[model samples]
Target: MSDVVTCLWGRAGWDRAAQGLLGAGRRLADELGGKLRTIVLGPADEALVTAAQAVADSVVIAEDETLAEYNPESYLAALTAACQKFAPRAVLLGNDAYGQELAPRLAHRLGGSAAGDAVELSVADGQLRVTRGVYGGKATAVIALMKSPGVIWVRARAMAPADAGAAGEVERVRLGIAADPRVKAIARHVEAKEGVRLEDAQLIVSGGRGLGGPEPFQKLQALATAMGAQMAASRAACDAGWVPASWQVGQTGKKVAPQLYLAIAISGASQHVMGIADSKVICAINRDPDAPIFKHCAFGLVEDYEKVVGPLAEKLSRHS
Candidate 1:
């Protein structure tokens, strides 16, 4: 079997995180003395193929009617087929929902090892090692996968996207995989969103329970709007019904790695800090001087949010 490092693309198509996977995959392949391959689900248009071809040594398109809807079973089957055909040394998937569900199952089907939510990867003594957060982001742990075709789902914004240059091979493979009859997608509800997604936001303004109630989110939103940043909430705010569940960011919610994360009135519990661990710069403003958030922030201000938010919003609006 030829040694290869494989990365998978999801149903929605190639995103920044997926591009980051290519960069990571390319590194893994180089360390293993192998080639980098990418498997794209559904139809891959000319633009998609051209883009992927620039980084990967080869690209495999797994096209099937069942692949249109994101059914775990169909995806797993197609991915299995690709792995069997490619005989990769390792398979990298995104840490998002799609990869979280498929990585383990694909490993089980292929009789290999599996790990998820990995932040770092490396090859030592020809074995694949994965580094990930543990204890709700209080610490980190590293594990080595001894099995062939080590399956890993990488965290978002783990690294920069692969630099494009290679003129790689491209081919399409049809896997006659059918959807699982037991799990029919009867309906789909897409959350309406504006501006950049939380995972993809460069600047983020997040709030917490200390804001006292849902009304404070309006002020936070105003600041976010003036700064052209996305708004997020801690679990407390979401649990208190102050914001939509989709806006929550924490261990139990979404993980973000923005360039700047401005946390207002947040206590910065470990679970919440876990989500923003990858953020480049963290800033906190809380009335409580001893709030846990101050410990983790690069810059912190101790002041009542009511007194600080209005002026901050006004100043930011003026500057904009």
Candidate 2:
């Protein structure tokens, strides 16, 4: 059996996360000395097929009207059948909601081992091991999978996407699965966001509770605009309704790995730091010298955000 990596296409077909997923799969498959077979559940658009082919040995499409929206039961069934057919030595999925729900159950169904939120994978002495954040991202734990067909949900931005190459073979499958009537989806509401999605942004400007109120976010937004970056928030700001829930970034919120992450008045809780651990460079603007965020950032300024943001925004605006 080869290594099987499965992902559902984004609403517009292939999205940014697709490349990283396939990249991880490619690495694991190469380490295992097996072919990488990626299972994508969406329309087999030419662009998707071409991109996946560049990284995977084979690309399998499972497209049907029943598979349009994400229903846990239907997706589980589809993945179960696909894994069984492929008889994969390992299975990889994203660490988002879908993977968190399905990974353990899929392992149970397949009689394999499962791990979640993995950031690293390797093979040593013919055994597969994974490294993941522990204790709310303050520590790391390495786990070894002793069973065949290890099911793993990898964190986003954990690996650089594999470079494109010659196209590979493509296949199509049908599961004839249907959504359960008991769990019909009424409607879905997506939060409207301007500029780049936080996950894809190369730069980010984030705020925390110390900002005092929602109005401060406007200043951060202005800084973000000047810097050509996305805006995000800590959980405290979101829970207080100072920022939209979608803007929250923490262990329980969105994980981001921008080239530069600027924290404004953030205290740097471990949960919050965990979300930005992958960031290339972290800078903080907090008045408190003992703020935990200072420990994690490469650059730190002990000044009130109000004193720094306005001037910084003005300077950046001039350059822009």
Candidate 3:
């Protein structure tokens, strides 16, 4: 069998993460002189098939009623079947919850090596190399995989999306794996937060421990609304009960790469900075001039957030 790069497309529709995987897979396939194959495990949809075809050499749809929702057991079985059938040189998956759980397990099942949270990937001297953040984003490390069929989980927003190419043929594959009886997904619970999703937002306004309490988040929220941005918080703020855990953006929280990130009252700890390392620009407003965040930010205002935030929101509102 020839070298092949296989990517798993999740049910998030052909979202940015999927696009990144496809782009990275395409480059790897080109370097290996192989083909790029994408597999979708849910019920088939024309839109998904078309989008997958735009970037992949071939699309495989594993259609099964049990896969209508994510069931770890059935998903694993189907993935195993795909690996056996395709005999790929490498397998790429998004570095999200599902991919984080499946990459290692699938690698173990296939007797292959796995890499997680890869921000960059390339092939050199016939070996697969993956680059990822280390030491909580204070540094980065590159790992070389010697084994064939390397499984990799790619970080979101790290790779650019692949341009739409010629549509490829679609193939349907069915795996006989049945859903486990012990585990059932009766319903999904989504957060009721309004405004743009933090990960998807182009601009973000974040607060930290300087806010002191939850009451100040409303001010940040108002600023965010005025600027058409999303509101987020540092881990300290979330831990201090000033905001919901979902709003936290740090090593222990969501990784973001927005075009602009405005951090207020944040100390800019390595853990917090790691999450926004990929942001195009960073601006900090803190009373402490020595705040670590100031060193990493593109712009800094050493002033109390309370004195500036309300007036800044008003100004933005007027401009809007």
Q: Give the per-residue lDDT of model 1 (tens digit) for 175-266.
A: 89977886788889998978788998999999999899999999999999988999999999999999999999987888899999999999
Candidate 2, residues 1-320, lDDT tens digits: the string is: 64656564535455656777788888888888888888877566888888888888888888767777877777788888888888898899887778889889999998899988888988888778999989777789999988878999988475778888847798877778776676677899977768778887899999999999999999999999999999999999999999989998988898898999999999999999988988899999999999999988999999999999999999999999
- How many clashes does the backbone of model 2 have? 0
Report the number of clashing residue pairs per model: 0, 0, 0
Question: Who is ahead in TM-score, 2 or 3?
Answer: 2
In candidate 1, stretches whose alpha carbon ends up further than 4 angstroms from where it belongs are: none
lDDT preference between candidates 1 and 3, better one:
1
> What RMSD value applies to candidate 3?
2.0
> What TM-score quantifies how close candidate 1 is to the native fold?
0.95
Number of the candidate with higher lDDT, 2 or 3: 2
TM-score of 3: 0.93
Point out where model 3 deviates above 4 Å. Answer: 1-6
Q: Residue by residue across 1-320, what tens digits does model 3's lDDT show?
A: 44555556546776667777788888888888888888887765677778889889999888777787888888888888889878998999887778888889888888888998888889888788999988767689999987767999888567888888858779886777787787788888889968767877799999998888999999998999999999899988898887888998976788788999999999999999988988999999999999999888999999999899999999999999
lDDT of 2 at 189: 93
Ranking by TM-score: 2, 1, 3
Clashing pairs in 1: none
